[model samples]
Target chain A: MRIGDLAARTGVSVRSLRYYEEQGLLDSSRSPGGHRHYDEEGVDRVAYLQRLYAAGLSSQTILSLLPCLESPSAATSDSAFDRLVEERDKLVTHIAGLTRTLESLDELITLNRKRRAASVADPDSGEPGRTTQG
Target chain B: MRIGDLAARTGVSVRSLRYYEEQGLLDSSRSPGGHRHYDEEGVDRVAYLQRLYAAGLSSQTILSLLPCLESPSAATSDSAFDRLVEERDKLVTHIAGLTRTLESLDELITLNRKRRAASVADPDSGEPGRTTQG
Candidate 1:
């Protein structure tokens, strides 16, 4: 399939497909007309790349772990295995930070809700917002 | 204090601090020599910015939501309030995706561990990794 076809199937932009190719995170072959072509497995490969990218793995790190990611076993090189463990630990830390940020957002949301409720009760918004038991 | 002081205090790089200023997420004043300076509140503001960035907010989104981030109240502009809610939803989605990736990594780790254990038991590893007993 053409690059555009892969992009459409995966919902990833063609530009990003090109970037993944540039970063060596993806592969393609040139057609007779010099257009990029991908095999049927390209769909699954693109999705896998997206998952790793979403996991916050840098291209270099992803490249190192590619062998393990594509095929998991005890036969994976010691360095690749170590990289997998390290990346996993980093994900844990990032998730914790994001969770804290979510908590802060929730607090802000709650504060806003309470203030709105107070304003409604007091009619301090100045437009007679109160409804008489409607 | 200078940019370096804020960086040292927060452990964020000076370049990142400058980027935050350019993004309007951090405030600074210039002295007669045109050196950027931050006041005591700079420390807290940098930390706050770090939290927001960790939550995966883009600079533009952070800029729009700054008024509320600096001080949350019922009086925040309607647009900023809406942005705050929108950002919260995005964070939820991102956290969910990261959680899935973490699970995938855990599965890969378990697969490798199982492979290693099986290799040891079968002795096909050919190295006699197992001990007879102490």
Candidate 2:
């Protein structure tokens, strides 16, 4: 597939795909006519890259991790797998914190919506005054 | 408290605190001695900024969200709060996805560790030969 197909499949922009290639996070083969072509595995690889980026991993870090992901044997040596485990643990903790914060934000939104509905219905004299509604 | 103190309290580097100030995500008053002074609220604000960054939000996005957090009234107008609520929802979804990936990585690490231990104990044979452990 071409870059456009990869972009469409991965939901990443063409510019970002090119940038990822430049950053060594992705690679494509050159055709005889100078066109770039990606294999079927490219879709999964791009998806993984997107997940890593969304998880706040820098492109350089993702690039380094990609080789380990592709070859587990290479990853297991020299405690590389250990480092990956540690990084994943930290990511899990961070995700949990974000989840809690998100829940609090959702509760705040629900409360705010209820208050808005109450104010709209009454239009006056509810809680203190309209000046301090928020 | 000074910027350095806020940095220490929030676990954010002083340079990043200044960068956050430049990005308008943080605000501090200047004393007569030309030093920046932050209130107790600054610690919480900086902590929130660090979390937002870790959650993959850009400094600009955090900056826009900060004003809404500081003044809920201003946030309520034109559905500004609604946008924040939606963004938070997306963040929650992203965090959940990351959590799942992290768990999968943990399982992979555990399996790899067990396989390694078995390989080391026997130095051969286990699961259809040791040619493919990973």
- Residue B90 alpha-carbon offset, candidate 2, angstroms: 1.0
lDDT by residue (tens digit), candidate 2, B1-134: 99888888888899998998888778889999989999987887777667677666788776656534554432255456666776787886887778767865665566666666666767744343222112
Off by over 4 Å in 1: A28-36, A123-134, B28-40, B121-134
Write down the C-alpha DockQ for each prediction: 0.27, 0.28
- lDDT tens digits, residues B6-44, model 1? 899999999999998888777799999999999988887
What's the C-alpha lDDT at position B91 in model 1?
A: 92
Query: Taking the tens digit of each residue's C-alpha lDDT, what string does model 2 give over A1-134?
Result: 99999989989999998998899877899999987799988888788777777777788766555534655442246455666676787787787878766765665566556656666766753433222112
Against the true structure, candidate 2 reaches a TM-score of 0.77
Global local distance difference test of model 2: 0.69
The window of 10 residues in a row where model 2 chain B has the poorest summed lDDT is B125-134
